[model samples]
Target: MDTSTSKVYHVDGYDSRQYLEHYFSDKPDLTFKDDTLIFPIENLTKIFKKGHIKGDLMIDLSTGSMIHYLLPSCEFFKRILVLKVKDRCILELKRWLDTRTGAFNWGHAAKLHVDIAGNSDQLQDTEEKLKSAVEHVVKCNLAKENMTDPIVLPPADCIISAWLLDNVCKNQDDYIRYLRKMSKLLKPGGHLILIGCLEISYYTVGKDKLHAFSYDEDFARKALGEVGFVIDDCKVKKRKAQSDLADYKAIIFIAAHKVK
Candidate 1:
């Protein structure tokens, strides 16, 4: 076992429900109004329209507690695989996906999903599709030789990593190593869509301080290109936060394809 990846984060005990509310909850209003929502949805829309994402298999490298990231594009893929680092995150997701009673209410996110897709009537069907589309929720280690263990997976056509690496990595080298590991999950010419925070070093989980790696778009672009990815486009969305959710100047979205 690799002790390097065994940095057992107390993240399972962290307050994920509160975190989701601070960032993605639409309980306040409709319209997908937050700046956090803007860049990801808009660029994902562009990616789908440009035919950059579509195929049988989509691998989700970061399965944050919320499913908003999948709402925009999971339909494009026939099979979806989600990997998470914490049991708590997987538990939270299963509560929703399995429609259990104590599920963290994602009605607001579902409503916002319809807002992003503009399919007023597809809401119910979308939820059903999501529940069925996700093939599995497995634990993963980015530092390992095989990220997903026991179950060996075939290469994927598209990979999604949202607000992921920057939050989990402690430095630039760590970030690049994780990126290289994630890139290997894709088939040749497969697309990679990354959503990350820009210029930030830490995030809060209720009261505990969770550290992150500070970075900019140029560094991200260069890193991805050097890691066997052909750059497509990069978009940044800026917004001021009213809470201490995460300190950063902007949200960076990158679209790239595996070149090797």
Candidate 2:
């Protein structure tokens, strides 16, 4: 009788929400007091203004969940092309961008393009939410898809990848390849701005695990140099995380130029 013991199981919804929130929400450190995520936009605006990114066309790779929310604040770009690594983000971003009541003013706006490449296994549900929000969207993969190859891209004044390279790229070669591909997307003497987390560990979304690479100012300069991009001025800003459990507490922003 002693050998046969009953086992009790308990479930805590708070813990479950905490775990789920970790993946679904933005990094704790990246959030602001106003409840508005403005770091990416602020960083992009800083670089664009500093680098003089005014041009006829602008391309944004991996437009994150909040890009369209901040686009209106940036008045330099005449036309914006958003290339999302995952289809869901593209759909969500497009919906937000097209919404008249949304953060971005879509009424008096320039052309907006959305390219959906590769499906994200981690954020599938979120992707679905995004897909339902948009009508005109392109589906393709950034690595294998040839439809929108940046190499043969039409002349553009500038190209921007907001916190994208470090996530998709695995190693140095991958980074270089991405840079080269992006270089072909820009016109001569164009600029490229990369904003990423430095020394970050793995993050999870739902049940999926997303790995973060260690990228800093030096890494940006070196990688951009190999791809024929000149290091103009890299501004490193210290970003901190509010959660004590988080491994990474800070991040840096890198701004560089592509030379002819």
Candidate 3:
């Protein structure tokens, strides 16, 4: 099956709830838990603990309505500004933030974060803290020079994009272009943390198949460098779960700072 022909993310509509249920459920595929969930939690925890990624504001340009990636960041940033490409995603996030009924539960991921901190009792508090830190969920258009047009956001101390570029980028040029836009959102010397899958080109959300741009660690490093970011840390993990939901062979997490 040629995954390159799959529907591109953001260009087409997405089912936010289904995406969460499929990849972030209580018994998610083991590899996804290890690579996507646990890996970012651990890295963010370490980065925050070291006091390098904290500030008054942090912007999140994530793929879906996902908040698990920001769970560990709530402690460091006083405000979180989330930019979503789709209205459905914004609604999905607000549903959870408002604590509405039928909202997807993220207890499993929250527990993992608390467990890593060795404070298992803070599971509920962890979610609440993230919710408090997230100050806004605004719609964004990457095609625009000011992605969040009509609202010029203050430069952030940190920016985090997870599993986002792989879905929207059709080629290397697109990756670099989109990355530059993200870089503009950060203040000089501010950090950019990226989480993405490597060397595969498809993921399933319910019955729909979505496209993913395939690239290696070196290309990623070069892309970040080209976008004026200095690499701080890069972690890659081999696929551990054998699932057809996504064909990715590995996952990557990179921490870099925008060059002044």
TM-score top scorer: 3
Cα lDDT of all candidates, in order? 0.75, 0.50, 0.88
Q: What would the per-residue lDDT of candidate 3 be over residues 87-146, giving only the tens digit for each residue?
A: 998899899999999998988889988988788978868999999898988999989999
- Poorly placed runs, candidate 2 (over 4 Å): 1-36, 68-74, 100-140, 145-152, 244-246
Among all windows of 10 consecutive residues in model 2, the one with the lowest summed lDDT is 5-14
Overall local distance difference test of candidate 1? 0.75
Residues 1-260, candidate 2: write the lDDT tens digits.
Answer: 12122111011111222332342234444332111234444455455555366766766664344443224223565566656555545555555545524333221111111111122242223323333333233443556534365434466676667556656666777777888878877888887876666665544333334545566567778888888888765655565435423344355556677885
Give model 2's TM-score versus the native structure: 0.66
Better of 2 and 3 by lDDT: 3
Q: Pick by lDDT: which candidate is best? A: 3
Candidate 1 or 3, higher TM-score?
Answer: 3
Mark the 10 consecutive residues where model 3 has the least summed lDDT: 24-33
The C-alpha RMSD in Å for every predicted model, in order, reads 4.6, 11.8, 1.8
